[model samples]
Target: MENKEVIEPEILKQVAKILKVPVQAIKNFSEEAAVNIISNTFSDESVAYTEYYKYTINPFEKWVDAMDKNEQLFKELLKSEREKIELPEKLLNEKKGNK
Candidate 1:
């Protein structure tokens, strides 16, 4: 893509805060990677919780930590997935696109 659509900086920073991870971890990722992480995350709101068990160490606080983590993870997962999918050349070549 001429331009890759990445997550907003402000939103990514907010997510980083909840995950206790550095903003650069997510911010520095390529747009395609970012898209995958977020898409994979929110693909199924209900299933999102199940995925967390695989990522973290202790029980997350309900409504607060858990929710925040899920949201942040969703964004990251979408980005990761996007990176895997690889934007098609046609889309990437769009005159207005940026990648």
Candidate 2:
């Protein structure tokens, strides 16, 4: 595979944004180090672009998928916790009402 000689400024900015790090971090990276950083950062488009030095698939897809999974897991956990706390209160309230 062909390696990129230098990463574009715009791409570096995007990577920094995704990683929540300063653009200087990316700029200061050696080419190989930058490539490794992009790959591990999991910014799909950035990773793919760094790999092939071109756009491939939709980069946002991976981010969206990860966010969706997290949201679903959070909802499930909230529901479980709510049930644990509510069940006892529900029983107590019902018993009081019936007495």
- Structural similarity to truth (TM-score) of each candidate: 0.26, 0.38
Clashing pairs in 2: none
Error at 38, model 1, angstroms: 55
Candidate that would win on TM-score: 2
The TM-score of candidate 2 is 0.38
Q: Please give the lDDT score for candidate 2.
A: 0.83
Q: How many backbone clashes does candidate 1 have?
A: 29
lDDT of 1 by residue, 1-99 (tens): 226577777877898999898998865758888778788876565344554555755554555887898999999999988876676645667745663
Q: What is the Cα-based lDDT of residue 39 in candidate 2?
A: 79
* Candidate 1 Cα misplacement greater than 4 A, ranges: 1-61, 87-99
Candidate 2 worst ten-residue window by lDDT: 43-52
Badly placed stretches (over 4 Å) of model 2 are 1-59
